[model samples]
Target chain A: MLNRPATDTQVTHLQRLWLYVLCGLVIFFLIVPTLLVIPMSFSDSRYLDFPPESWSLRWYRAYFNSPEWLQATAVSFQVAFLTMLLATATGTLAAYGLHATRARSSRYMTVLLTLPMIIPVILLAVGIFLTFAPVGLNSTIGGLMLAHTILAIPLVMITVTAGMQNFDINQEMVARSMGASRPWAFLTVTLPQIRNSVMSGALLAFIISLDEVVIALLIAGGDKATLTRRMFLALRDEIDPTIAAISTLLIAFSVLMLTLSQILQSRK
Target chain B: MTAADHQPDAPMNERALDRQARAEQRNLMALSLPAFILVGSLVLLPMGWLFWMSIYGADGFTAENYTRLLHPSYKKTLITTFELAFLVTGLCILLGYPLAYLASQLKPRMASLVLLCVLFPFWTSLLVRTYAWLVLLQRRGLINNWLMEWGLIDTPLKLVHNFTGTTIGMVHIMLPFFVLPLYASMKTVDYDLMKAASNLGASPVRAFWQIYVPLTLSGLGAGVILVFVLSLGFYVTPALLGGGRVMMWAMQIERSMAVYADWGAASALGVVLLVMTLGILWAFARLTGAIGATEGK
Candidate 1:
């Protein structure tokens, strides 16, 4: 194709300038609040103030020292870790199974697996709360982990399935033909090829659990309160710099994990 | 003797291969079984229970919970929730499309860096993001303070704890949902087509509107459906920013369950919300499919 002459580029310059301005404003709007929290977390003031007159580590110290905050953080980590393990394992298996089987029922199963992503989260929380209340699963870490796993499974399935699509099944078949068991063949041949997707999916599941709030609000309580649930209540009940400090830490942690996942994904 | 031996063993090799295929099929079924059970019990079963609770009432089976939706107050809340969702989704498209376009036009490496700004918000917790807006938009918050110092207004704007604050917070959270899909679709567009159009003597604007814009309609459709559905179920942003003044359906469900302890009513409201969301998506998909068919022709 011929590169369009200077006339085309020149004529669109004014329009492009306006597009650039709008894009810049949108980027600023999306990023400014997240960027502001870091500075607000470090502010020496008791109240949230911008362009801090002075900075101190007091709020960070407060977050570290507070039993309630610490417990919530611990619970969040525990639930997220369990969610990562369960979702990744089940989702990876489901993806592989679906890819291997050419049955008509697999399409319907794919829809069933992805329904959690489609349904409103509030609805899920309400349903789970009602269902688990009588069974005594409410206010427990296990219940929260179960809920997070349901939410994370679809993500893992989507990611791992994308990886599975690119894999050459002939390699696994060769392994099987060499007298390897089905599981053994998969472990030796297929798993290594799709390890990146599995890792990324696990990272995503961990983040989903860590950031989950609605379900935690409905089910997780007392000693099992997740970090997000605590931050939510603190925001509602009181306005303090401690929430800011915690928010900053959460942001940093997420950024770190996401970057790590990106690196893993790009290695291939 | 060797040829005779090979011929006799062929039948045995075929049976062995058959058994292995059957074993692999069984293994595949077994591998997927746990996920099926997990999703079934935790997700599908609860959803079924929710529907059952919606219809189940004092006298045995009653529509009282659904009838409650007819009340003027409840109707208003439903209308307002949808209206808010529509407004937010519209704003997201307006702001996101240009940014997505700009990102798509950039060099590959530069595009990823620009796209990171969109993805960063997804990493941060929704509560933290909403709280960040609260801190910035409050009466004595950063925006107001900056405005005052610059002598922009006499009084602090009522930015937070209102419709304005709720909309802004939602739009901020939803912009990425719109942009990422829009950018992905745009990247796949053949810029060469635009060149072809210009070469045919069409003006630049004509080429863009007649060629490029039509190509992006599918992305536009996808982004609209995604943002609209997600926004309809939004609870945290509106609750925190609206300060109980603005009530969406999700908050209503919360109140019904937590405050009133009315399981039937809460479940009924949830069913309505779910049905409406699914119905809208189904309609959107049909509409887009028709549009795509016509465009192909």
Candidate 2:
């Protein structure tokens, strides 16, 4: 509208046809595979072939009924929760550090923090396994949390940093001028401003930890198996429809997260 | 120094604030140390150790590990990894660029919805999405079932347990990475620029390639590097979809650890990968900086 052409404003028929075809292709790519999972999950037969002989909820039932699967799911949730808490707190503090100091060290600190994300996860997994070897930290939930925390910290850092760009430095200055301690000035004046960023980063970290399998698989053993690890093992050992069922559930959960994130971002 | 110019009460308060600010800085650093140490110990130290082991040999320091990696068999593996990463990144760009462009063209409400569709799978496990591909590409899988029904083929095509399946799965998993950054960058593109180009007698295609493409280079650079880096590390997708036949470097490292119990070889492989990643990051940074300097000038 700001810079329109001299030509007449009319919809060309060929352009409209092309537009429809493009939109159709986009919709097809996005929707079809997601929809395909539904019937695949319900296949009455043992194999994963489509055009099911009949549809049933047996796989869904199996997913819920299996103790191993349920336990893994519970573990995943717990790990994700802890990861969010740890990553959000540390990440926000680090972001604040960068904001407050404007220190050259903060740049170095950010690299240190985000190194986990930049490195290959498998390599990170191997590193963690070796690092934990001397201390015998293998296969423990605590060790798994630590590994996930490293990976998750970068996410929190990025999100919180983005959020902190809107920080009102003047507010802190004002508080300081009133003889408030810097910590008090920040806690009372600054933390509240970036709360949404903190929350969103926490949520993202949680989802990342929950959905992570490679690290969880490398570090978490036996009783510490995450839902993803369970799914991987299930897929490798058996062609159960239960995996499809679980995948459907996970996809729904992801969609829910995506919606929530959008709603939150829009509100901002 | 500013306190010297302050009023009586102002000087006292300013002094206190200065002390407090210093304390806050100190405290922040103190709090950050634990995170730094934790990551450094776990990631940094082990990475150093991987490099150290890579150079160490039976007779002391030797490049035998690298020499071993140069074997024809391993060369094939390396080529396949690059090929897979290259193809997957290309496909992601192909599939992602238009959707990003289209999304950019949409109303805010519709754009958000389409963006949501793209990001939906991101929250799910990469393993789950790869597993979905397994079901979709297996010999007796959904696609094969549909094709046989349509008489498109009398026999199921060898889709899964091969390169095609691996590429499809990797691209699906990586598409979001390509789209999100491109979309974000494209959204920031000045719409008026495109319109101005068209109004100045340029065709729409010319406007897009000339204005939009060059402007979007940073995001494209980022998106491609991200997709390539991620694809390099991809394990579950190739393993699950490629069915043991697709021996990726990640699988090689896993075998070196689990089956062979050869820490030296595994760490050496890990070192090679780490170096490759760092090299990519360095190159990306240099390229971006040059672009930035050029843009600034």
Task: Specify the highest-TM-score model's number.
Answer: 1
lDDT value, residue A199 of candidate 1: 93
**Which 10 consecutive residues of model 2 chain B have the lowest summed lDDT?**
B1-10
State each candidate's clash count: 0, 0
Runs of candidate 2 exceeding 4 Å displacement:
A1-13, A16-20, A48-51, B1-24, B57-59
Chain B TM, cand. 2: 0.92
Q: Residue by residue across B1-297, what tens digits does model 1's lDDT show?
A: 788878988999999998877776777866777788878887799888888888987789989889988999898898889899999989998898889877998878988888888989988888889989999999989999999999999899999888899999999989888988899899899888888888899888898789888889889889989999998988889989998788899999988998999888899999998998889888997998898798789
- Candidate 2 differs from the real structure by a C-alpha RMSD in angstroms, to one decimal, of 3.6
Candidate 2 structure quality by residue, lDDT tens digits, A38-99: 67788777785576778888899999999999999898988888888888887777777776
Interface RMSD of candidate 2, in Å, is 2.6
Question: Which one wins on lDDT?
Answer: 1
Number of the top-ranking candidate, with DockQ as the measure: 1
Each model's lDDT comes to 0.87, 0.81
